[model samples]
Target: MPEPIKVLVTGAAGQIAYSLLYSVAKGDVFGKDQPIILVLLDITPMMEVLKGVVMELQDCALPLVQEMIPTDKIEEAFKDIDAALLVGAMPRRDGMERKDLLAANVKIFQEQGKALDHYAKKTVKVVVVGNPANTNAFICSKFAPSIPKENFSALTRLDQNRAQAQIAGRLNVPNNAVKNCIIWGNHSSTQFPDVSHATVTKNGVVQPVAEAVKDDHWLNNEFIKTVQNRGAAVIKARKLSSAMSAAKAICDHMRDWWFGTHEGEWVSMAVPSDGSYEIEQDLMYSFPVNIKNGKYTIVQGLKIDDNAREKMNVTMKELKEEREMALAACQE
Candidate 1:
């Protein structure tokens, strides 16, 4: 067997982590042949809960999970880690504004980012899964200057998967039949789900998603709003934020990133922009990206209609405001 890769997961005792850890152990994130040593971290108060989680992993006897370390120490958890998932953050409660939540998470990511910079392998890939993920990712990357900006990304795949599923359902096709769906800009409600270039396969025939759905009115209004607000709808229905689907999306994101996307296919990731589509540089913004040889390139040359441009601007504006708030917080 190959040497076990050290994988660190923050917020190890939370609902999302609960689902994520098991999937990783089962080789859902990493390939089946690759072994992993999981380093699980949480706050001191949650150490006992983290221990219970470790015990359960032990009970499963998953061969891919070569070793498990549960700790409250960031340095200990991140030491020589190959990949880190920043999943723990203060969830927005009733009456909490976006800026308020961003402020609270900024402090957490800043400290954790420093630990990652000091202890993790320079090539470590970090995915920020916490709320206000795009901004949290930017804050973490800001503190970890030694790491390449390309090494950090936010989890926009959840939004992308939701968009794909919605499109497939509308066209009465299997989920795998949908390709090239893009979730652009922030992960918040201001996000834009673009199917303008997507294609769907039905009855052994492939065609543009717009052609398959045949309802521009629904696509423009209900589909975009539904994808944007799906998280809130889940919270309302489940009495808790989405756990399983979120974890699944994280796995999907990491898998595609590490394993590469299929030829001619792209996935959505919130990566540092290089001024593509006129987006500002250095912001972790969602774009359609194609991966190969463990590197990603933003998909280029797609025409952005006036409506899509309007939606993109709205989310970009929100992200810029959040970036300003994060900068102010860092200075404070």
Candidate 2:
């Protein structure tokens, strides 16, 4: 038998975790034959529900080995893990501004970051799924001075996936053919899904959609709105939060990081900055990326139009503001 890959999933009791844990265990994301050791990390209060999930996994008899661990100590949960899905955070409540929310999440990720520094494997690739994910990733990466900043990223694959699905429906093509769609900037309303570069391949014909739908002004405006606000749309229709798809996004984030990006396509992830496209160094904003050798590399050199550039600059500023605000709080 080969060495088993150890995957640590935080927020194991989350709605997203419900789909995530079972899917990974049943080999839907990772290979069916690949042996895995799953460490489910959650707060101690969630022990009972976590135990129930573990029992279900046991019944499935997956090729993977699963373990349940309810703990508030992130250091203990992440030690020696190959991949850590840093999910679950304090969701915003009424009357809370984005700055307030960012400050709250910074504290949690700060502790987790310190834990990762002290205990996680040197090669650990972390994906932050919590709200304000890019900023949360910033705290973790900055705190873990030993880890390469590039090893840390936030979940934007869901945005990419969502963009692809929406494009497929509008263009009437199978999702497999929609290649190279990119979501740039914060995973919020400010995010830009640049379908301007998308290509749809079907029936032995490859269609360039950036031009095909360029004239559909209504669609151009509506598609962007739909892609950006799809989260709210789901919540409105379902009358609950988005747990299943969010969980799926976490899986996609990890799966691509470990396995591979498509030959000609890359997904979006918020990664530590090297000042690309004038993004401030270390902002942890989302960029198009290709993963290799257990790491993610930003796909630089893509042309950024004025509109795209302006949108990204706004989100970058938002991240920097959040960072500075957090820093000020730390000082106080």
State which candidate has the highest TM-score: 1
Cα-based lDDT for every prediction: 0.93, 0.79
Runs in model 1 deviating more than 4 A are: none
Task: Write down the TM-score of every candidate.
Answer: 0.98, 0.93
Query: Candidate 2 — which pairs collide?
Result: none
Cα lDDT tens digits, model 2, 193-270, are 787777887677877776544555644577788888877677677765577888888878787887888777788888
State each candidate's clash count: 0, 0
On a 0 to 100 scale, what is the lDDT of residue 146 in model 2? 92
lDDT of 1 by residue, 306-327 (tens): 9999999999999999999998
TM-score of 1: 0.98
C-alpha positional error of residue 320 in candidate 1 after TM-score superposition, expressed in Å: 0.5
